[model samples]
Target: MHRTQYLNSVNDFIDWFASNLGHASLFAHSYIDRRSNPAAPRTLAFTTLFDACKQYHWKHNGAFGSPAGACLQTNDAALSALRQALQSAINTVNDSKTLTASSAVMSWGGVRAGNVRWLTANSKGLAQTIASVCAALDSDNLSHPVLTSCQPLRFNAGMTKVYSLLVNDFIIYDSRVAAALGWIVVKYCQARKLPAVPRDLAFPWAPAKEAANARLPKNRDPGLGNYHFPRLISGELHAVWNLKAGWILAEVLARASHNPFRNSSTVPALRQLEAALFMVGYDLPLNVSPSGVNSEPESYAEGDWTECYTAARGKLFHYRVEEGGIRLLDGRFYPVAVINRMLIILVELFGTDPFPLANSATKVRVTPSIPGIGYAYFQATDERGNPPSASALAAVLHELGVLNYTPDNRAPWALDFGDYVQRGRIDLEALLKLESERHDDVGELIA
Candidate 1:
């Protein structure tokens, strides 16, 4: 397909989808208010696209954008209309005649402002090349070398799987999504607009002091713990102590009194926040023993740990301090979903933008510290200074448990295109190959 046709299809699809999404948002608000509870309409605000699909009626073979979509059924008329709209939008883009060419122009203008550059390799070594020479003859200011040499460039189109499977495609990565949703609600309230009953609206639960204290006890004494608790002192005495004990000590004292943990009131709020995230279809463990901690404390034990765990459905979090800039920690790397969920919620309240390319349609999600993939290992120098063998690399990752994700990497691409046989998410044939499985659906759903 031609570039112009491809762009037109994509633009049209976005227009249709965005328009339908606006209506869906309003319908969702009304559905929550009328059917569930009138007072706490915002309770269902974070319902995911998948959750919405299930709540309404959406049927297909697998994840969104998949071709086997006609199999699904829904009894609800309005929901059926919405699902059809989404499917039509996707179909219009995929069926574009302009994108038919095997090799199409890949524009980076949205991301790099025409100065975009990527490394290219050859038998000799990697030499910086422009995208213009790599493709057909194109504008110099707005293009790079044409990247047509197959073995020389070493292009792998399959890398897109990671972007779709790991990254959250929702535009909500930026605060715009939440702000837009919130704006809809605020407008409804201001205009006294009410719609039909909500299907799952209820009074959003509030945390209680007793419940919060039950999970973690308050420590008034600073000496007994690593975190110090503050005590009241007069301004003159505080000034004198600050001068004598150093600025660090005085800062610690002030932080102990004001920090979220020391405040005590935040415990219940955290607990309630945890509960709400769980409700929104995130897989977060309620309570789990921290690694290396003994099974002695009331909160620390195997029995106390909840079996709740869902992979792919992890949380995204980003934070910044005066010293450190924006950093995102997607919780899928953790063994326990609870820890992941906690970090997710904690960051949402205190976190910044989750990833770069916050507004683009094709942004890559970074999987932090993934063993063997991100880091390069060179054990011994070859006569000509060559890289290590694949077998040696695999051995190193195996020893470090980098290759072995706790849930076992039954990822999306393997089923969709790899050797795994059968159809549907977690095809029965695929399960037969596994010894035991916890969250295979995680790969498909997240993808």
Candidate 2:
């Protein structure tokens, strides 16, 4: 893609998003009005839009049933309670009562409630610790106070609320937001044609090599393993990760501010950018089904079915079908019901024949020598009289190396039989005739 075109698209999207900010919240209000609204007390309008993006993501990913409201309610209650306790401790201190960490914990009625466990073991230092961090935060020196002073209560979940509420410049540095910033950093580097940044530098939330080893799939090393899966960062690294996250956010914002497309008068705030990057990194609506196509699987009655095919390397591969899914030769499993439906749709649209006759005898045979090209075909017998399972059909198509299914739905399926051209010129006329007969047979069966 052309860089200028991509940049234009990004700017256009940002403009559109900024214009629609009022739609994110329950009540329609301008960004300026919402920011100044004390009663509503909303975060930046971009944050609300980002939350909407996340909701769309969850719904598409089949996990939208989670209790989002309940989670928010609990967090709100905890933050409110903590603020009340902190105010009471401050009032007592003003009245000349000794405000020890233990006394503060007692003042809060105990550390067992809500997310107050960070003050349990370090109860003795709670009052001094928070005071020092707040002081450093006020002075714009968070590394020493927030990172080092707050030991058990690290920067992310522990001190984020305090800083974000008190400090005008502070932005939340939780795992999700950090991951999103990392993704943006990587993308920015790629767009600028810079050397790839270290994964650790980009994604601070990833576990260390030693910790990651245990979680990786068997027989896979760090280089070959899938790093897409999310892992929790250890507490030991939280301080460093938070520092790096903050730095990355600052750098990204600095770069974004320099963009000529950005309006200097109405440039997006760092928090708004943070929300946008979070949506980009996380499963948001844009990354989901942009098209109207429903890529998710439809219900299908499933049964046990097994099929075998030979790979390009001549190694035999087996697909064991169970329910709506299939287990590949490499032990990786995929749900093929949706894929099968899509394949059916494609065949219906293209008028191509679906392979593997439902009633054929169990055997593998090479197609009769065409004028130039020949192909291998697998014939499987089903005495149970059940139709070929979707997994079985998909497995056959995959073996042919001509069916392409992009799970993300970012692209449509493709069929490329060019490999046969290298062996010999394909007999297009005969192949077309055979396919025509098969399509007719399939059409008759459907009727």
lDDT per residue (tens digit) for residues 329-370 in model 1: 221121122222322322332232221101111111233322
| Error at 89, model 1, angstroms | 39
Q: Roughly what TM-score does model 1 have, to 2 decimal places?
A: 0.19
In model 1, the worst 10-residue window by lDDT is: 107-116
Output the lDDT of residue 130, model 1.
17
lDDT scores for all predictions? 0.21, 0.34
Tens-digit lDDT string for candidate 2 (1-447)? 222332343453234333433333421111222112456654333334335232221110001121222232332333344455555564454322212222222212211111232333344545555565556554433344344544554444434544443344455454335545444443344444545444444444321111122221111111111122133343424534444444444444444423322342232345454444433332211111224442321111121122353322223444443334445655655443333333333443333322322222322122332110011112112122122233344434443333432232323233333322112233223322332222211110000
Q: Residue 365 in candidate 2 has what lDDT?
A: 27
> What lDDT score is found at residue 40 in candidate 2?
62
